[model samples]
Target: SQQGEEDPQALSIQEGENATMNCSYKTSINNLQWYRQNSGRGLVHLILIRSNEREKHSGRLRVTLDTSKKSSSLLITASRAADTASYFCATGRNTGKLIFGQGTTLQVKP
Candidate 1:
Protein backbone atom coordinates (compact mmCIF):
# COMPACT_ATOMS: atom_id res chain seq x y z
CA SER A 1 0.00 0.00 0.00
CA GLN A 2 1.26 3.47 -0.85
CA GLN A 3 1.67 5.90 2.00
CA GLY A 4 2.41 9.55 2.63
CA GLU A 5 4.82 10.88 5.26
CA GLU A 6 4.59 14.26 6.93
CA ASP A 7 7.59 16.21 8.12
CA PRO A 8 8.29 17.87 11.48
CA GLN A 9 6.37 15.45 13.64
CA ALA A 10 5.24 18.48 15.69
CA LEU A 11 5.03 22.26 15.63
CA SER A 12 4.28 25.14 17.98
CA ILE A 13 3.11 28.65 17.25
CA GLN A 14 1.36 31.62 18.77
CA GLU A 15 -2.18 32.54 17.89
CA GLY A 16 -2.53 34.51 14.64
CA GLU A 17 0.69 32.99 13.30
CA ASN A 18 1.26 31.03 10.16
CA ALA A 19 1.96 27.27 10.04
CA THR A 20 3.41 25.20 7.26
CA MET A 21 3.66 21.41 6.81
CA ASN A 22 4.85 19.16 4.01
CA CYS A 23 3.91 15.71 2.81
CA SER A 24 5.65 13.24 0.48
CA TYR A 25 4.06 10.17 -1.02
CA LYS A 26 5.31 6.93 -2.52
CA THR A 27 3.31 6.42 -5.72
CA SER A 28 1.07 8.08 -8.24
CA ILE A 29 -2.20 9.35 -6.83
CA ASN A 30 -5.52 10.57 -8.07
CA ASN A 31 -5.74 13.41 -5.60
CA LEU A 32 -4.12 14.69 -2.43
CA GLN A 33 -6.18 15.84 0.51
CA TRP A 34 -5.42 17.59 3.79
CA TYR A 35 -7.39 16.96 6.95
CA ARG A 36 -7.35 18.30 10.46
CA GLN A 37 -8.22 16.43 13.66
CA ASN A 38 -8.86 18.18 16.91
CA SER A 39 -8.27 16.51 20.27
CA GLY A 40 -11.33 14.27 20.26
CA ARG A 41 -13.09 15.42 17.12
CA GLY A 42 -13.41 13.59 13.85
CA LEU A 43 -11.12 14.43 10.95
CA VAL A 44 -12.30 17.47 9.05
CA HIS A 45 -11.41 17.91 5.42
CA LEU A 46 -9.33 20.98 4.95
CA ILE A 47 -8.76 20.94 1.22
CA LEU A 48 -8.24 18.72 -1.78
CA ILE A 49 -6.07 19.51 -4.82
CA ARG A 50 -6.05 17.19 -7.75
CA SER A 51 -2.83 15.71 -9.10
CA ASN A 52 -3.00 17.91 -12.17
CA GLU A 53 -3.55 21.04 -10.16
CA ARG A 54 -0.73 23.14 -8.85
CA GLU A 55 -2.39 25.08 -6.08
CA LYS A 56 -5.67 25.65 -4.29
CA HIS A 57 -6.93 27.88 -1.54
CA SER A 58 -9.83 27.95 0.90
CA GLY A 59 -10.26 30.81 3.29
CA ARG A 60 -7.08 30.84 5.39
CA LEU A 61 -5.83 27.52 4.04
CA ARG A 62 -3.57 27.09 1.04
CA VAL A 63 -2.47 23.87 -0.60
CA THR A 64 0.14 23.22 -3.26
CA LEU A 65 0.81 20.09 -5.23
CA ASP A 66 3.90 18.95 -7.09
CA THR A 67 3.15 15.76 -8.94
CA SER A 68 6.61 15.57 -10.46
CA LYS A 69 8.13 15.49 -7.01
CA LYS A 70 5.34 13.37 -5.55
CA SER A 71 4.92 15.87 -2.78
CA SER A 72 2.49 18.46 -1.44
CA SER A 73 2.30 21.22 1.12
CA LEU A 74 -0.28 22.94 3.30
CA LEU A 75 -0.01 26.44 4.69
CA ILE A 76 -2.31 27.97 7.27
CA THR A 77 -2.28 31.72 7.47
CA ALA A 78 -2.98 33.52 10.71
CA SER A 79 -3.68 30.36 12.60
CA ARG A 80 -5.77 30.54 15.72
CA ALA A 81 -5.61 28.74 19.06
CA ALA A 82 -8.65 26.79 18.00
CA ASP A 83 -6.57 25.55 15.09
CA THR A 84 -4.44 23.45 17.41
CA ALA A 85 -4.78 19.98 15.99
CA SER A 86 -3.17 17.12 14.13
CA TYR A 87 -2.78 17.59 10.38
CA PHE A 88 -2.63 14.66 8.01
CA CYS A 89 -2.13 14.30 4.28
CA ALA A 90 -3.94 11.59 2.41
CA THR A 91 -3.29 10.16 -1.03
CA GLY A 92 -6.40 8.90 -2.78
CA ARG A 93 -6.30 5.83 -4.94
CA ASN A 94 -8.64 4.49 -7.60
CA THR A 95 -9.90 1.91 -5.15
CA GLY A 96 -11.41 4.72 -3.08
CA LYS A 97 -9.09 4.08 -0.15
CA LEU A 98 -7.02 6.86 1.32
CA ILE A 99 -3.52 6.29 2.64
CA PHE A 100 -2.74 8.63 5.51
CA GLY A 101 0.51 10.07 6.72
CA GLN A 102 1.82 9.93 10.27
CA GLY A 103 0.64 13.56 10.75
CA THR A 104 2.00 16.82 12.12
CA THR A 105 0.78 18.14 15.45
CA LEU A 106 0.38 21.91 15.72
CA GLN A 107 -0.14 23.70 18.99
CA VAL A 108 -1.32 27.27 18.90
CA LYS A 109 -1.03 29.31 22.07
CA PRO A 110 -3.29 32.24 22.68
Candidate 2:
Protein backbone atom coordinates (compact mmCIF):
# COMPACT_ATOMS: atom_id res chain seq x y z
CA SER A 1 0.00 0.00 0.00
CA GLN A 2 1.18 3.50 -0.74
CA GLN A 3 -0.74 5.00 2.14
CA GLY A 4 0.81 5.91 5.44
CA GLU A 5 -0.82 5.12 8.75
CA GLU A 6 -0.28 7.26 11.81
CA ASP A 7 0.06 5.71 15.23
CA PRO A 8 -1.93 6.56 18.37
CA GLN A 9 -4.70 7.97 16.17
CA ALA A 10 -5.22 10.66 18.78
CA LEU A 11 -3.19 12.88 21.06
CA SER A 12 -3.93 15.26 23.92
CA ILE A 13 -1.57 17.91 25.21
CA GLN A 14 -1.43 20.86 27.53
CA GLU A 15 -1.44 24.39 26.18
CA GLY A 16 2.28 24.84 26.48
CA GLU A 17 3.31 21.29 25.75
CA ASN A 18 4.52 19.48 22.71
CA ALA A 19 2.81 16.73 20.71
CA THR A 20 4.39 14.10 18.52
CA MET A 21 2.96 11.63 16.03
CA ASN A 22 4.50 8.91 13.90
CA CYS A 23 3.48 7.59 10.51
CA SER A 24 4.55 4.47 8.63
CA TYR A 25 3.93 3.65 5.01
CA LYS A 26 4.31 0.75 2.58
CA THR A 27 5.89 2.08 -0.64
CA SER A 28 8.47 4.45 -1.99
CA ILE A 29 7.42 8.06 -2.26
CA ASN A 30 8.63 11.27 -3.81
CA ASN A 31 7.73 13.43 -0.88
CA LEU A 32 5.61 13.68 2.23
CA GLN A 33 3.37 16.56 3.29
CA TRP A 34 1.87 17.26 6.68
CA TYR A 35 -1.50 19.01 6.76
CA ARG A 36 -3.76 20.42 9.43
CA GLN A 37 -7.54 20.51 9.48
CA ASN A 38 -9.24 22.82 11.91
CA SER A 39 -12.75 21.59 12.58
CA GLY A 40 -14.76 22.07 9.41
CA ARG A 41 -12.16 24.04 7.50
CA GLY A 42 -10.36 22.56 4.53
CA LEU A 43 -6.96 21.11 5.19
CA VAL A 44 -4.16 23.61 5.19
CA HIS A 45 -0.69 22.60 4.12
CA LEU A 46 1.75 22.71 6.99
CA ILE A 47 4.97 21.42 5.52
CA LEU A 48 6.50 19.23 2.87
CA ILE A 49 9.87 17.53 3.01
CA ARG A 50 11.33 15.72 0.08
CA SER A 51 12.33 12.06 0.19
CA ASN A 52 16.04 12.88 0.25
CA GLU A 53 15.65 15.15 3.25
CA ARG A 54 16.01 13.81 6.73
CA GLU A 55 14.56 16.55 8.90
CA LYS A 56 12.86 19.91 8.59
CA HIS A 57 11.46 22.53 10.92
CA SER A 58 8.99 25.35 10.37
CA GLY A 59 8.26 27.69 13.24
CA ARG A 60 6.57 25.46 15.85
CA LEU A 61 6.38 22.45 13.58
CA ARG A 62 9.09 19.85 13.00
CA VAL A 63 9.08 16.99 10.55
CA THR A 64 11.37 14.03 10.11
CA LEU A 65 11.60 11.70 7.18
CA ASP A 66 13.15 8.26 6.93
CA THR A 67 12.96 7.00 3.38
CA SER A 68 14.84 3.85 4.24
CA LYS A 69 12.09 2.84 6.62
CA LYS A 70 9.29 4.43 4.61
CA SER A 71 8.14 6.44 7.56
CA SER A 72 7.85 9.99 8.89
CA SER A 73 6.98 11.89 12.02
CA LEU A 74 5.48 15.27 12.91
CA LEU A 75 6.11 17.25 16.07
CA ILE A 76 4.41 20.36 17.35
CA THR A 77 6.20 22.49 19.92
CA ALA A 78 4.56 24.75 22.47
CA SER A 79 1.18 23.66 21.31
CA ARG A 80 -1.86 25.82 21.95
CA ALA A 81 -5.51 24.89 22.32
CA ALA A 82 -5.99 26.66 19.02
CA ASP A 83 -3.85 23.95 17.55
CA THR A 84 -6.42 21.36 18.43
CA ALA A 85 -7.41 19.64 15.23
CA SER A 86 -6.64 16.67 13.00
CA TYR A 87 -3.29 16.12 11.38
CA PHE A 88 -2.75 14.03 8.31
CA CYS A 89 0.27 12.80 6.39
CA ALA A 90 0.13 12.41 2.65
CA THR A 91 2.64 10.43 0.64
CA GLY A 92 3.14 11.58 -2.91
CA ARG A 93 4.38 9.18 -5.55
CA ASN A 94 4.95 8.98 -9.28
CA THR A 95 1.41 7.68 -9.61
CA GLY A 96 0.20 11.30 -9.16
CA LYS A 97 -2.15 10.50 -6.32
CA LEU A 98 -1.45 11.33 -2.73
CA ILE A 99 -2.54 8.54 -0.41
CA PHE A 100 -3.67 9.68 3.01
CA GLY A 101 -3.91 7.49 6.04
CA GLN A 102 -6.46 7.83 8.79
CA GLY A 103 -5.37 11.02 10.57
CA THR A 104 -4.33 11.70 14.14
CA THR A 105 -6.59 13.95 16.16
CA LEU A 106 -4.83 16.35 18.52
CA GLN A 107 -6.53 18.05 21.39
CA VAL A 108 -4.80 20.80 23.30
CA LYS A 109 -6.22 21.86 26.61
CA PRO A 110 -5.83 25.30 28.07
> Model 2: clashing residue pairs?
none
lDDT of each: 0.93, 0.91
- Runs in model 1 deviating more than 4 A are none
Number of backbone collisions per candidate, in order?
0, 0
For 1-110, candidate 1 gives per-residue lDDT tens digits of 24967987899999989999999999899999999999888999989999889999999999999999999999999999989999999999898999999999999999
Please report, as a residue range, the 10-residue window in candidate 2 with the lowest summed lDDT. Answer: 1-10
Give the Cα error of residue 14 in candidate 1, in Å: 1.1
Can you write out model 2's per-residue Cα lDDT over 12-109, one digit (the tens) per residue? 88999999998998988999999999989999999999999999999999999999888999999999989999999999999889888789999999
TM match of model 2 to true structure: 0.95
Q: What is the lDDT of residue 88 in candidate 2?
A: 92
